[model samples]
Target: MELLKKDNYYHIYNREINSETVFQDANNMSYFLKLVEKYLIPKVNILAYCLLNNHFHFAIEVTADTKDVNQAFSNLFNAYTKAYNKQNSRTGALFERPFKKKTG
Candidate 1:
């Protein structure tokens, strides 16, 4: 996991474990976005985003650039995964790994 730098733009992404569907329905997508808004919006300025069946992408600019940024991402995924697992009656990891990021 790379630490986000202040004022830096980045492309961040993640995929579902085993190439499985992450957003099974419209409600799932909405919930995931809500989690993003809650946890990521404060840390980065979102430029663009795409949420597919098994993966998600984000174009963003770092805002605060604190170490807590990673924790925010972790919280976002953890919360979403927990909700998804409970809703779908499944358990274990949701994402393939910690999200990957690149300068863009």
Candidate 2:
């Protein structure tokens, strides 16, 4: 249960492969925000963030057990992929990785 210990913050991100556009337009950004708003809001406290063309940056505090982060991030990432696929009419992953974590 050591990973469950509530002791650090994490900055996590993933990029589109080959430096492609992740946020093709404003709606993509909007969709990502909505996903974060709905899923990551309760479990994680976001300190800062920036969404660029092909990647995103987030500074967040995990107030509870660290085990919860993967699920929280998965929800956000899945939402993004669904939106991206629907918008772009393509399939497969949007992110290079599903989840990445760091201790802070």
**Best-fitting candidate, measured by lDDT?**
1
How does candidate 1 fare on TM-score?
A: 0.94
Best by TM-score: 1
User: For residues 1-104, could you state the per-residue lDDT of candidate 1 as single tens digits?
Assistant: 55778888899999998898999988899999999999999988999999999999999998885677777888999999999999989999999786889997
Per-prediction TM-score, please? 0.94, 0.85
Give a tens-digit lDDT track for model 2, residues 1-104: 13423546877677886579999888889879989988888778889998999998888887756667657777788888887888789998888764455667
RMSD of 2: 2.6
Model 1 residue 11 lDDT? 95
RMSD of 1: 1.0
Candidate 1 runs further than 4 Å off = none
| Residue-pair clashes per candidate | 0, 0
Q: Where is the poorest 10-residue window by lDDT in model 2? A: 1-10
Model 2 gets an lDDT of: 0.78
Error of 1 at 26 (Å): 0.8
